[model samples]
Target: MLNIDGASKRGSTAGCGGLLRNSSGIGSGASLVTWISVMPTLQSSGESLIYGLTFAYDRGFKRIVLHVDSNVVVHTLQSDRDHSVVGWRFIQEIRRLLVMNWEVQICHSYRESNACVDALANLGCDHEPGMRVYEQYPTSLSSLLLADVMGITTPKVTSL
Candidate 1:
């Protein structure tokens, strides 16, 4: 499964991140994707999903479960609505990836449960230019990955 999140604050660089988890919920392969060009939150959200899916595809993953923390992205892609807007380009790319002879199950995840991705996104936001790839799980994510692997529960809080 791939869990993703995006971080964008005014006056801060925008970035997104994602991680891959095996069936047993062990995150072995993770990457920290950083976009030097700052963009809107919506765009960053799409970037995260697109990057994660592309990474999985490139790594030869046939079946993937994608977890995204943005409702707009999840709904836009799942609903199959295609609007030719600059902000929607990433959505189109995500759709393109979905049809590439692979089985993908995409869903919305609570933000609270996406601690690791959120951190990665923030790290990317503050990181210097260029991309940072992690073949193995980053040492920085040990605690978050442990909680995820151990099924440590967190409250599912949402906004109205």
Candidate 2:
């Protein structure tokens, strides 16, 4: 499974999300596979997990390697912590899904390593005209988005 970590920065605010694909090379130029965007914050409960499980079950993913940037979410999914909170319930649902035939594991990657995913995530929060496509992307975009999120002027990438 290919895992992507993504973040979006809006003016003085930021949001993050992840994309997981069955193909090992969605962004690496290896294989093409349908992908799913995973957002625990968006779910805030078992709703998203249940939806994901049903979709994965129908799609027949042999093994599921869960990729998550949120350490809290990852830990909760790994243990039987009886967190009855609505948010924790979703984590439990994910755990239950893990117990199925699908082999479940988690991997962590620096946000930079998952730029494509991060861009997609950013779009989810504050989509702008320039962010619609990956091709011809500008590096300055990172600074711009960060500046917007931080409510600061976009920094000059170089003094020149």
Candidate 3:
């Protein structure tokens, strides 16, 4: 399963982070960031999705379940009807990846359900531009990772 999240300090920095667990659940992941000082929030997420898909395919994984937190990204991917040129580009690339000989399931994951990726995305901004893969996760992620395996959840608060 690939659980991912993208984040941007709108116009300053942007990054994507996710964990890809093997069939038996062993894990590896990447925190790829762009130093671009003026990227949109949506585009960063879209780019993150692209990176995630390519990483999975490169590792020769044949079955994948992609869980993402952005509803716009998820809806656009599933429907392939995005109107913006940038969005169209991202969607097109992702579509090409999906049509490969693998079985991939894409779903929308709520922010609370994706706390690890959220933290990773934030931490990702600290990385120099480019993708960094981990055989072992960063020590900072220990608690979140443990919480994931234990199914411990954090509360979500919304301002009215």
Candidate 2 residue-wise lDDT at 44: 21
| lDDT of model 1 at position 92 | 71
lDDT of 2 by residue, 1-160 (tens): 5343434343433333334355443334323322223342444224333444545555677776655555665566665666547566556666667677766566654444445445545554554322132332235345533443354542334475
TM-score of every prediction relative to native: 0.82, 0.53, 0.84
- What is the full ranking by lDDT, best candidate first? 3, 1, 2
Which runs in model 3 stand beyond 4 Å of their true positions?
A: 26-42
Question: Residue by residue across 19-65, what tens digits does model 3's lDDT show?
Answer: 77865553323322111112334466877777888888888889999
Runs off by more than 4 Å, candidate 1:
10-12, 27-42, 83-86, 158-160
**Ten-residue region with minimum lDDT total, candidate 3:** 31-40
Report, for every candidate in turn, its global Cα lDDT versus the true structure.
0.73, 0.47, 0.74
Across residues 31-63, which tens digit of lDDT does each residue of candidate 1 receive? Answer: 322222224454677777777888778888899
Error of 1 at 59 (Å): 0.2
In candidate 3, position 85 carries an lDDT of: 72
* Model 1 quality (TM-score): 0.82
What TM-score should be assigned to candidate 3? 0.84
In model 2, the clashing pairs are 6-118, 8-122, 12-149
The residue-level lDDT of candidate 2 at 87 comes to 68
